[model samples]
Target: MIKAVHGDITKLQGVSYICNAANGIGPMGGGVAAAIRKAGGKEIETEAIKVCKEQNPMPGDLYVTHAGTLPFQGIIHLVTMKQPAGPTSYDVVRTCLHNLVAYCRKQGIDKVALPALGTGVGNLDKAKVAAIFKEVLEPVKDIEFIVADIDQDFIALFA
Candidate 1:
């Protein structure tokens, strides 16, 4: 089941993990990433950077790290752009969603919360990206997704 919720992603309950639309090199400088870093803790960013150092992630890759001070099992970083503040296309967003599903299935993760991919610094259309999320995730089985946003308008499209 995929549900849309209006609020801060960090405040979501009953979810063991949340998704972060991140860049190839992890910084968590602005937008949703920054919010997660602030609420969760700076160590979240440090852990992501440590993972990047091992193998710099490209778009469509999924990396998991400790949730720091957040109340979750882990944070799933979905690489949406090659660099911080770089542009991302609908194709890349689609690819990331597909990869996320694959990773979740492979790892047996059942529930996750995610924000609108590529709509912030990546500048992709929110509605379009939301549609892509529905297109990819609606068909998957045994997974629960919460598409969270601060904007009510963005969350409404998921209705």
Candidate 2:
């Protein structure tokens, strides 16, 4: 099941993994990623950097890391761009969603909190990103996805 919510994704309850619209280089410095780091702790970023060193994940790849102080199983860093603050495209977002669903199915992740992908520093339009999410994820039947954002326009797309 999927639903839209207006709030901070970092503060969402019952979700073990919250999707971070991350850059490939690994730094949770801005936007929702920053908020999550602040709440979860610097350890989360440290783990992310370690993963980057090991795998150097590209756009559309889902990198899993420890949640630090946050009360959850893990954090899913959705690499949307190659570097921090770089732009991302709709196609990348689609690939990320597709990979996320596959990863969730393979890893048994049932619930997730996801924010608007590539709408921040990536500069993609919220509605278009939302459409891509719906296109790639609407067919998914097992995962309980919460498409969350503070922006009403983004949430309205899911509604």
Candidate 3:
């Protein structure tokens, strides 16, 4: 079953992959990207760039790359925003998660990890964000979802 948890993104146990809230260019930006880079190293950045080049992912599009140095088996980086740079919104969050599920299904994966998609730099409202996720995800029963919100209030919304 899909579950919500509050924890460090770097230390998620058992899940094979995590979603990176990346930009169109696909570099490791701040927040979750920074934390993943700190644990996984720059090779992750290089691999993401390679995939980003081929995909040119816009908001809601999904890109896949090997985890590089991440402890996880692979990374499914979602471009949650357009190039100008900044916090993502509810639209970005909702679409990114859909893209993520599609990619996960393609790869024969049933369980995955995610950070709160547009909340950090995106500055999206927590209640709205949680509601959007629950709405989109409440119906997809093919796979199990695990999203980690860095903040506590978001966790309550999901709980």
lDDT of each: 0.90, 0.89, 0.79
Model 1: per-residue Cα lDDT over 49-129, one tens digit each = 999988889998878889989999999999999789998899999998999888888888899899989988888888898
Q: Model 3 Cα displacement at 66 (Å)?
A: 1.5
TM-score of 2: 0.97
lDDT value, candidate 1, whole model: 0.90
Per-model TM values vs. the true structure? 0.97, 0.97, 0.91
Pick the winner on lDDT between candidates 1 and 2. 1
Task: Please provide, for model 2 over 1-159, each residue's C-alpha lDDT reduced to its tens digit, 9 standing for 90 to 100.
Answer: 688899998889988888999988788999988988999999899889889989999998889998888888999999999899987889999999999998999999999989999999988998899888888888888998898887888898887
From the highest lDDT down, the ranking of the candidates is: 1, 2, 3
Q: How many backbone clashes does candidate 2 have?
A: 0
lDDT top scorer: 1
lDDT of 3: 0.79
Give the 10-residue window scoring lowest on summed lDDT in candidate 2.
Answer: 131-140
